[model samples]
Target: MSAWLRRGTAATYAATLGVLLLGAPAAAAAPSAPAPTGAAAARKAAAPPASVDARLFLYNEHGQAAVAPGDTVTFVMSTAGYPENVPQHKTVVLELPEGVTFRSATNQHASGPCVPDAAGRKVTCTTQDPVDQLPATNGAWWVTTDFSDELPLGEYVTAKATLTTEIPDPEQDNNVSSWDVFVATTGDMSVAISAPPGPWKVGDKFDATFKVHNFGPYRAPFSLSSGINPVSGLRYSGWPEGCGFDPGEMQCTFGVLEAGKTFEFTMRFEVTEYDADGISLTPTIYPGNQDTNAANDKASYRAKIIKPSASPSPSPTGGQAGGEPTLPITGAPAVPLAAAGLSLLAAGAGALLLARRRRTS
Candidate 1:
């Protein structure tokens, strides 16, 4: 009986250990190693390669921001693109104001000669090529217009330009440019001449100061010429900054004078002869481009230069009725004195000749 009990307890302990082992969870597996990368897997996304752009600007030979009537403005049109075979509409449209007209236009890629034609104030520049090659893409067109005769102070003539391309433009800001050129003339430039102080002496140099005033409305460059009267006996000796003596007139140029502005210039004149009673300087101003009034364009001024008074000669008798007691001429005859002087001059000449001949021999 004791041996049977011991065997049954050992069998129960073995069964419980087997049940515990079966109920426990399984251990986790090892982490996986990554695969090697290739060239195809390393590539990144990129932007589109093909694009075109257009820009417009105004230019001139002298690079001035303002323009007057009959002035030319160069409209520079530039277009460039990468992978350039893109079918695009490259154009520049000029929206001008009233009183402005298109003069001419040229295109390098034009199929035929560019004879610029315009409809009123709208000017158009567009390439006709279906697929425009970017190599011959840049070009310019010249347009001219007449500014108003009179413009208000600080006002400018304006024109709008729109540059475009059919393809996507990387820069959309520069596609639109505008021109604001000032109309350079607004008023009449009136000038006048003033003669120097009068009663000048003959054979003396003098100066004539001129006061030029802008009487009309706008600012303008002026060319002034003073007509020198030949009878005035006043010869042009020198002139101030903008003055020059051209043929019969003393000419000078004043760049730009604004309204209510005054410019002073001095021209020197010398009295060449006596009897210079009514010397005059007639000045005429030719304002730039246009002039409003013809009547007031010129004015006259006069000056005087006279000969000095003559003094009375003293009497040979010293103002006495009876001349001082004088001894009769007791000297040799004038003919004999003259003969003696001639004989002495001949002897000196002979001596000089003898000395030269001896030196030569």
Candidate 2:
């Protein structure tokens, strides 16, 4: 009777422990959260749309952000940001502004040339082969556009470029790029150097005058640089406040010169004893803007160095009035000539004295 009671009590305790262990987990477990809705749901869904990427950009061949009217400018459509994920073919659609016309598009990596539509307003660059690698995959195209002859100066022109690939882009913001260029005007810029008068000897200091003139229908705001090439024996001093000097070059800047306007400054330079025959100053002007006449953009001024003449020997003044004629003594010392003349006189007197003694005897 005792064994049966002990076994029954033990079995009841084990059953209660098992029930507590199973019930505790369910009571401590956290509740389930609600699903995302509306914009949040949309954003989550769009987060991992695609693995590939496409980006577009437009820039000139020179990498400058401006363009000139009546000029055929070469532009680059760069899709270098496209990824090398799946072997996907890429395409670029270039939309030009109204006054700009597409001339041609070429890609060194493409199997064929980029083609333009009938109106020449749009150009498409696509490679038939899949672009899965860099360089070998033609990642860029060179496009040419001819601006209308009448594009107004200082106006802003915008060109847009769109890049697409076989794979979808997760981010649409980088798929298109636009470039804004200012319609630059033409300015004829020329430089003139007025060096101080010749007879410029060593150790002489003088002013070298420089004049930069813009003979234009428009002002020159960009690409304007003027400078003087330094001569070996020339020393620069009293430099113009606007000019800068490196070791062997002088750089000058004149900001925003208008048509028929000129900027003048003088620099003082001294000649050193170093053997420099003549000084030639070639001041070059590169307006960087469209120059109508380039012939006069560079001017050269050459100044000759005159050497001091050797003075002629002073010939004895032609027989000064009532004065003895004096000959220019040449060779050795006057003492030797005087001694020879005395010896000759002594011999003649001795010969006369001996003859007189013989007559007396």
Candidate 3:
């Protein structure tokens, strides 16, 4: 344990520890070194521009028959834009045709430019006043207007409305887009039949009427046919005197009807004596070669014939009055045995009394 030897050992250990710590830091720094070039930053900045497409669509609340000369039709506008950052709401101008008179306009939850004509006949709109502006949330824009009383009938009229979308383009000015709306004239034709209850008794006759209406723009050709419901015991009277089917039989007839006009056909039917139960009286429309769609093709009227409970003849023994006889009576003579025997006894007594008188004399 010499002091000089101990001091030399301590100096050597301290020097070793310092060398180990310095070497450890150099090794760590070599593996964790930062790159001089920023490749990720350059890739993000040089990315390609995104593609954008915008579309607008208009729909009428009423389908095929939505438009009428004096009816109000609603037009709904919607838009779809790509590149999620695009702005949806903007100024919209609706140019209507002479026939379509704008009554009033409104926008729910929108702010900007809106102006209406002095007579409230035409509506000029902007972001501040959208004739029919949709919310900022992309979707439907709707407005309804009534047809002016001056709108003429019997003709198809078309009107147009325009919707403008302001798409924000910070890099460019005047970034407005527009869509078109179409309004069409409306009309329809329909027919219905009204008939009385059937199952009429034999020799009974009845009348029925078929009413046809023009609910649409133009005149339509219609046909009517009347037939007996075999199950109803009812039959159509053969060709009413002045009235006859187009083909000469009462089976079918044709006629022309003008818009808003009503036409009726009266038919008569007779109930036959031999007609069976469950027979029906029916009338049907035969729209032959008509341009009307199948949806309006034909309508039917029906009545049934039920057997009557009373009859002239009494029921045969053990058989129902209305049903065929179970047993039939045959030709046979009737005899009375009690009268024959009484006559025979009288004759015998008279003969015996005569014999007794002769013997007594």
Candidate 4:
């Protein structure tokens, strides 16, 4: 079995609290208070006694909860939510699924030895000691199993585990847990990214579209995982739901995509500071199912960052390059203020001379 297709895991926590009245109410001695009503008394009498809560779960190395044939998997059975200083009648039972052979089991938290049946199909671990030590109510066991190489592809199998106590549990739903494992098949999964064209300048915001395409012979079930790298100069401004993010990386998971189908989403980014001449948004994809093509698994979109250009020095004469010097007019004339004033003064002098000549005539 290939490493990527070998393992997937599912884990969940369960807690059930049974309240016990260890002491009487402060007002119980008050004679003036009325006694309990008929229904209240009947209900109180019918209530069960307090007991320790126990939960069971099966876990694997990876979180996807899947497995492939011929793969050896180690499952961890964990017990939790057992109150302190309580008597423990703890017993854990594990049953193997078809086509899976049990190898071994070990106790981690309890004092009991794990005993497997003659055929290795079932195992039991138990402890009779009361939980005297603080936090001693927990139990954990490691169990190993191997999938027969003859197991067919795309087969879904389930392994069962249960935790039990001598006393009845307040919540029975969590006492047993089942881990679902799937035999994955290869589906050619690939990703492509499209970003707004740049010269992207600082303070500019844009959306990048990511499309995940499954060029398949099989459906990519249980979704897919993608890593969108945040290159220099680009800061994440917005993210779609169903994704997890960290500095410099964004992780997203999409639901099942059928063969030849594509899943599309968008992420908003802003150009904050430029660390290089360009930024490349490269998103790589890993399918929950097996994938054979590595070449098309990732795609990149490159954008050139536009650096701040130096402000042009004030033209020596306050005029733009290759253009004539612009003159400021005092009023409506298209001439310099000084030149217009001089012309007005000369015209006034000529008018005065003409008046003198007319008087002489």
Candidate 5:
């Protein structure tokens, strides 16, 4: 083709692209989000040039390249996102749902810090140390995450991964990857809670902290129940769901607890009376899809309430007011026998005369 004809075709193609990507989507979703502008239009038109691309792929453990519930996933990522002469950096961030767990980096492609958020739902793995940037030919780096056994089968949980760069990726769609995880069953679960150790006071609120431990090879749903001891008078003041209080009992049901993992919670209870110093209730796991051990599954949680004491009164010789006083006995000479006898006789006659006077009066 002639040089003039080729140049005219190129001009037409660029105009069409500018209208397609930079103009159309922005016109629809952008107006509802941000006000329309010519500068914004120009900026959007400039970012993706049809060159940059990053590929993030997910694979199951069995090498089938598919994800199944209760199985670990191998993530392979590489970069064609930058030019050969220039080094491309990727700080990958992934937010996993509740059922999926982040494993370790067996052969980490790039070296950086892997940190999880407080909820453990999101993790950021970056290459910050001696080795950084994606090597040539999409030098694939691999990381892993797993779905727990307790995860509900036939449910989909979204997994989002992002790659960060100084310049916008031309193929930004590949910079982020989205996939759904399908959960499957593994085995039975065993859950146990340590009884609260306490000699709590009566009529006062106290936390009945329980240490719930999962003792199983596979992750499983954690649900527990116990009838309120009628004699213990243990009542809930502040309760959370997964926990229920009926007229005679209270029960707790947790979504899932990972294998060899422990969870803790403080259930508020007020001591009504000291009738049962050692409060005990039979705790049992709410029967689920898989429950193996019934013996250890049903355990007792025992706590002691402080016994009441009665106030004591002061002793007679305790020096308290209104108490009987001690008698003093000083020495005195004994009276003569005749004088003693005459005195006794006079005293009797005087007593009789006084009695007669009282009767006459």
Candidate 6:
């Protein structure tokens, strides 16, 4: 063979051997699986964790009592844990009602002067110490907090607060579970009258004072008037100050009375005739926008007056000298048999005497 042909044959054989060796290894090795997508990984990470739910309880220490405007009120918070292995530690926050100011907090878990938020809006009250170890079944803790004198006098003012627990998991912290509590304020009123001494004589002029008080949550408007039972001998002479009156109609208007406030007015009456019977003074209260007749029907108080006794009248002649000892007899007419028999006997004797004298003549 020629040298060039031998060199070509040798080079071709070497190239063929190199291709076989590279292809055999590539075929033996398999392609690795693609990495999982971010979404799939996240889903796996988000798989629900094994956890226990926590619980809490809240109550009003004031017995859900009512409070008037400008009155400070306190509420009590009670908390507890549920389930065996759950240790609970939580933070609490409260949103006070309008017209109320924060006063003080007791049984605080943490220390430092706590106050309302910068806007003077929300209260930033929180528990200082952690609820270390909770009872297996049920355990509890409580605290009382007071509000400042900022309440407006009114009905149905609401006070509210919330309790929350932070749940811890390996993946995340501060998972919160919460509950809420609420309470309201109180309202009441008292009414009375101041008047002249009794045993009122005929034609005597007198005046009476009526006082109204607000003992409850807010202020209320009222109407005042007087009534007389003709039989009671009690009559109203002039309507109360600032009041308009007709013979049988009395009407007066009183504005609002703030909680813990009072108002008074005067009324006049003249005793026209002597009243042997007793009398009664009735004073009533009416809410705003109510009719006078309807208001009088809601009388809050009724007082009575008794007239002094009068001298006794003399007995008639031929009757009992004194009022006592006089007995009343009631029956049919009666005849006396003995008196009739005596009259008949006398008439017969007179006839006999006249006949005897005639015979003698």
Clashing pairs in 1: 186-217, 186-218, 187-217, 187-218, 188-216
- The window of 10 residues in a row where model 2 has the poorest summed lDDT is 221-230
| TM-score for each candidate, following the candidate numbering | 0.40, 0.46, 0.33, 0.62, 0.33, 0.30
lDDT of 6 by residue, 1-361 (tens): 6999999999999988877878967666768687766644443445332543444344455543444444455544444433333444454455555655565554333322245665443454433342332221123323334444554333444545555555533322222222222222334555677676565666566787777776645455556665554443556654446576555445676655676787876667666665554445656665432222343234432333445467899975455666556565545434556677889999999999999999999
Candidate structures ordered by lDDT, highest first: 2, 4, 1, 5, 3, 6
Instruction: Please say which candidate is ahead in lDDT: 2 or 4.
Output: 2
Q: Which stretches of model 5 miss by more than 4 angstroms? A: 1-188, 195-201, 230-232, 276-278, 287-289, 310-361
lDDT of 4 by residue, 64-123 (tens): 645667887776777776553344567888888877877765545544656878877787
Q: Write the per-residue lDDT of candidate 2 for residues 37-75, one digit (tens) a residue.
A: 874455445543366766777787765435677788787
lDDT of 1 by residue, 253-353 (tens): 66777777888867687777766445768888876535677677788887666767898998553333475655555689989999999999999999999
lDDT measured at residue 32 in model 4 versus the true structure, 0 to 100 = 77
Off by over 4 Å in 1: 1-101, 104-186, 231-233, 275-278, 289-295, 304-361
What RMSD, rounded to one decimal, does every model reach? 25.5, 17.8, 17.6, 20.1, 18.1, 23.7
lDDT of 5 at 7: 100
TM-score of 2: 0.46
Best by TM-score: 4
Give the better candidate number (3 or 5) by lDDT.
5
Please give, for residues 1-361, the per-residue lDDT of candidate 5 as tens digits: 6999999999999888887868766587654656546744553445444444555554343431224456777555444444432333457787787777777665644445566777666777765532322332233456677777776653446777777764456666777776654453434444444545776777866565556566656565656776555444666655566687776577786666677777666667677877654576666764333446556566666677777788798754443467766565345544666688899999999999999999999
Q: Largest lDDT belongs to which candidate? A: 2
RMSD of 1: 25.5
TM-score: which is higher, 3 or 4? 4
Which candidate, 2 or 5, would have the higher lDDT against the true structure? 2
